[model samples]
Target: MKMKLIDRFGKRLLYGSVLTALSAVLSVYVYAQDGKAGIQEANDKVRGYFSVGCDLMYAVGAILGLIGAVRVYQKWSNGHPDTGSTAAAWFGSCVFLVIVATVLRSFFGIQQ
Candidate 1:
């Protein structure tokens, strides 16, 4: 059975939204932990490690998200199949969420 265009778009959007939410949560958690650490002996013991890790993660995620967004847009505009576009959208959403969460946590001093 062939799927309708609306159905395909809806599915992709749903997947993308879910991924983005999860990423955002992860980012928030990471940021909060890092903030709590602050600059201290414990922070030194951790070697200020998570911050660097989070930064890298965010960078990678951002790149992926950008790529995914582009792919999704192209597919949608051209009326292509949903599979690839859906995957791309999901990836993009997750990355976007992660970046947003990280930024929020950093800005709000939520990090350890």
Candidate 2:
């Protein structure tokens, strides 16, 4: 059988959710280990404000991914195709990057 839109969207959402969750966990773990030492160092090295901006962007992406996942679930349950799955996936990627950046920040003391 051909894959349905809902199925594809659901899969994307699932992947996105998993990535976001992992990122969050990693960020927290690194933070606990060094108390944002990495973040501070990274910031000092970069000598710019882009890192902070990216962090905010990535957080927004995560939230958007979550919303997309919810929308996908609703569409699947109702036997409809979710139109926003692509957007969700993209946002999820952003979230993943954000998490990575944050963890890196904590690890390298960029934000401290």
TM-score of each prediction: 0.39, 0.35
Where does the lowest 10-residue lDDT sum fall in candidate 2? 81-90
Instruction: Return the top candidate by TM-score.
Output: 1
Give lDDT tens digits, candidate 2, residues 1-112. 3569889999999999999999999998877797578778886667576566666767787777777777767777777654466556756676687777677767655553
Which candidate leads in lDDT? 1
RMSD of every prediction: 21.5, 22.6
Candidate models: Cα lDDT each: 0.73, 0.73
Write candidate 1's Cα lDDT for 15-35 as tens digits: 999999999999988877866
